[model samples]
Target: MFDLSKEFESFYKNKVVLPNDKQNDLREKKNLNISRLKDGLNEYNEENKTDYKIINTIVQGSMAMHTVVQNDSNDYDIDVAIIFEKENLNDKGPLAVRNIVTNALKRKCENFKKEPEVKTNCVRIEYQDGYHVDFAIYRRYKKENESEYTYEHAGSEWTLRDPKAINNWFKDEIKDKGQCLRKVIRFSKMFCKSRDYWVNMPGGLIQTVLCDEKIQNSYERIDEIFYHTMVEVKNRLDNDINVYNPTDTSLSLLSTKDHEKKVENFKNKLNDKLKKLDVLFESDCDKSKAKNAWYEFFNHDYWKEDTSNEKVQKYSSCYRNTEEFIEDLVNINEQYYVTVSCNVEANGFRLQPIKKLLRSLPKGWLPHGFSIKFNVEDTNVPKPYNIWWKVRNVGEIAQKRDMIRGQIEKHVGNCKQEHSDFFGNHYVECYIIKDNVCVAIDHIDVPIE
Candidate 1:
């Protein structure tokens, strides 16, 4: 496929994936909205002489699933579930409950140019800067005093729903299926949302369901997997546009005529793009042509744009004196999927996962000098496999210090311990060999600040 792996990784990292700064901003905005909602509800209760109170609030949807992509319009959406005790509401209809939440938002969030409005299923508060929050109201009541509480969402009628069901479903898929699926879903979303012309396109949840249903996992690079997965999903959609909820098969996510129209449009467009990628399978296809094909598919220049001078300089500095290639030292077979994760420890105290710490900090980096223990967290390969570890360090500090370690070594256990000695985008890769053939592989990059 012309090996556009580097290009795809760069595009996904720089364009499709939301930056850490944007993620932090979204989290702050969501937190502010929640605070306002709760405070407004309190004000509503005091002014109306009512006892309405919020029992629970949960962030759901794409934000909760961590599949949110960078959009051109900056139109980020946050879905939250606002739950209350049914007895507190005294038997209110769906619209009535929505109205209460809308009024509460109106009372506290007066800065919005567009006021909080009650939708059929949620109360939406739109910010002037293009961010919106959807609060899905739900009520819980005990059928019998001794029985557990039953949850019902305030839809047209009170419909049974577990607010966390969809999120849990995606989590389970990631846990069992593979992490690559999450990246595929994000890339598909980026493609579907690349241009604003397709206004009727399926939303993130629907798109996620589609990807889950027709995902194509492979040992090939992520770019290839995404291309084939999009084709598979389009074929599936052509067969049927009805997308059932992953949490509940009985409920269809595409319940409206507009949703069906959106899926049809998406399927047709994807078909057209997949036809453009036919050049990829040709023997004469080269890197430039393959990337251009991807550009055509995504309708984005990220695929076609030349590497920036800054990136070139960064790469030159990192690799100017590097002589080791991990692949040259070991046989690499990606047949069985494996995932590696690490724990950051300081002063004998295990703090948190390295990736989690990096996401919480700026620039996807961690403090130097922390001890790291990388573990083979998940794998589908059978037991009795040989494990190999490689720690590669890059950056001016590492290069000047004469510590650019890139050796592949056999490890004694599933966990490999190392310390952050200097600044660099250091990474640890684990290779699993079964019967002298590398069966699975995974790597986790740890950027030292």
Candidate 2:
């Protein structure tokens, strides 16, 4: 049997988990926001003569648990619980408390590009660059015999919810399953992120629940863990079971009315991935097949090549040459075009330009000179860039004339080469090189007549 355990492990490490640098960047941003929130609240209380004291602020959700995936779009959603002293709730309702926090942030966050939006349960501050920070107001009652915290919910009601409790529960569960559990959850999340149907279907908490229940030390391989976990999740959804929050059992994670449709979609996506996993597992000794299966499953380019020995190459700079510059003045005001026509015979294939055929030339004939043009957009970079043209004979017929591939003038973008001597297929490639690195490339295949 084919084993993809090592591949899966590598994928998880490289693709699923966010890099340390990115994680640190997120942490720094979150801390900065937290500090601003505290300062904002303190200033608001002093300005309005309100006794609303910000006791503490706690980071919750995937940010705290370290299960967040690196989003290319920079839409990382952060959840922060803004805990206030119990005295703040003695005279104010949930909405009032929420508004106080929201107003404070709006007044204090003058440096932000956009104003903070007051949502039902949290104040959302969106940054121009992309990520957003959500501040959920919570009133902490530290009195003896009734020490607890109540969070704003539904704009008016105060609900008993503990963000730290859920985070702690997830941490304990991860400890029990060893480090693999976190990897499994992150991999599952990565799978969800790879597809559109599963994007918003399975949330972080729901995925955590599924992994905790299904991946009970049954298998050691990452692929097996993924398969079993997804299978169990599908079974649960098929049976119309509700996954409750570990912190609050009464609150069902899948409580929306449209959850049935969402669950059905999740099941369909899971089934498709499971089929691909089976294919990879059965593709023993077939490295290409296994890689293709993984590519299909992950829908990412990280698995496309082996890069263990490859060194990183950095280009100093790159720019495009404007089309008008190359088309009008560069070509000496002469219009250039290429035409291709193909004819298939029993023994060989022949390609010809329409101009040659229109002239009623003999069979297996070729054009005397083939002109190819290259151009690019305008750039602010100073001049003196090199342009190179590469032509190769790619036809089936052997003993054809040699192809030409060489550098042209900096301002020259047109290539009028002799093609009448060759009889087979040909390809022309153009590149703009700077500092020994190619900044732009274009290619076209030459067809024989």
Candidate 3:
């Protein structure tokens, strides 16, 4: 009666530490290979003489930043972006340029009796052990009124630079090329032990954006965004708390340390306020009593103004409702993950500890013979979705579910969304991918309002 699934996952993480030397070495070898391949491209370019030029050569991802190296023992891969330029919109000018390079590299590697480790474009090359090289092509630009107007290869986005302006906006931060890559590497490691999550999630666009000094350096409109994000994650995780902790001693408990710190900080900040308040010694009799106290405190003009007007209010707006009587299962993802899907898109689900929410939400204020009404909200379908929940402690998980469904049904009598029975199996779609390859990981919740 062993759960093989959990066992394998535990084994995989323990085995992964850091990428060995083989991780970076293939990058070195790839340089030699690219050099050899480039020689042939130059010959082809000279023969064609079509006036195409290599505009920029950028090395992106872990290898480029050097945080991760090539390890022969582990699976390592490298990526390269080779950018160039051409004129005709209809004709395949750059594609030809790309073809010559890719074809030449393919031919050279063919002697090894294998197709080149690559994709369609010549600028992009994949190396052994999960690394790749991307070649970027810059379309030819035109000089307009003393300004150089260069559109991206795709032509949808264009860059117009003033000749005199080198825009060292990040000059203080990204002084040199290596520093830029190093910063990126440091940020990339923040998300994963190395890049395993990137493989599981794939499309490391979030890492790239976080590494960009320009964005990091920007101070305007920053605080405004961060506060809202915290509350959003908290609110969403409050629901769908179905994640299990196995109640086993061997495995660690949910990361209560972080949660402890947060709660402690709040308690400390509120200590003085609690002291001056009249009901400091109020006993925990029922959730209903606590709810009454909290409501009374907030409803008072002085207390409301002190809290309701502050920036933290945005995040704290729903704090009481979320933690009132509920224990939740939270999925902490890499910074990039939360960055994109953010508010509604962060992944993982919370298991309501349904019974706990019911009993606790009442805050010790349960009326023994009271009947509860239930209703549903139409916005619960998922992202672009938000939920307002309060787990007023009911007796049992089954009882709580029934109570909540009844309440929601009363709330949504005309919404056409049915008052439904609880299904044992469900997947919470916290985050989703829209247009971009990057994902929006989300969570599920079963909240009582």
lDDT of 3 by residue, 1-449 (tens): 11122222221222322322243244455555656566656665577674444454444444433334221124444444444444533345545545666665664553342455334433555544444555444455565665655544422233332211111222222333323233332323332332232233112222232234223222222221221222232233344211222222243322455533433332332332333323423453333333333334223222223333566555434322211101012111111222111111112323323334346555432222222222232222234422222222222343334332212111122112111133222112222222221122222222323
Better of 1 and 2 by TM-score: 1
CA lDDT scores, all candidates in order: 0.79, 0.60, 0.33
Per residue, candidate 2 scores C-alpha lDDT tens digits across 1-449 of: 35677677657655766754465466567667777777887788788776667766667777666677753347677888877766655757777777777777776677676898888778899887788898887766644676554443324477767646776686567656765667677777777778654554657777777778777466877777776777777777677657787877788887685764555666778877767766655535476677777778778786686543333111101211111111111211001112222222222323434344435656544443443333343332234555555445443232222222222335344343434345555544454555443334344445555
- Candidate 2: deviation at residue 346, Å? 77
- Range of the 10 consecutive residues with the lowest summed lDDT in candidate 1: 323-332
Q: Give the CA lDDT, 0 to 100, for residue 75 in model 1.
A: 87
**Candidate 1 structure quality by residue, lDDT tens digits, 1-449:** 66787677767766877754466567667768888989999999999999888887777878777778996367899888999999899998889989988888898887786899989889998888888899999998888665777889999999999886776687667665576777888898988888878677788988888888777786568887888788889888878889998888988988889888989999999988888898998999987788789888898977766654697556545533343333334333334557788889887546789877777777777887798888888887898887887777776788666677766787567889999878887777677877665556566778888
Each prediction's TM-score versus the true structure: 0.71, 0.64, 0.33
RMSD of each: 10.1, 20.2, 25.6
Question: How good is model 1 by TM-score?
Answer: 0.71
Shift in Å, residue 417, candidate 2: 62
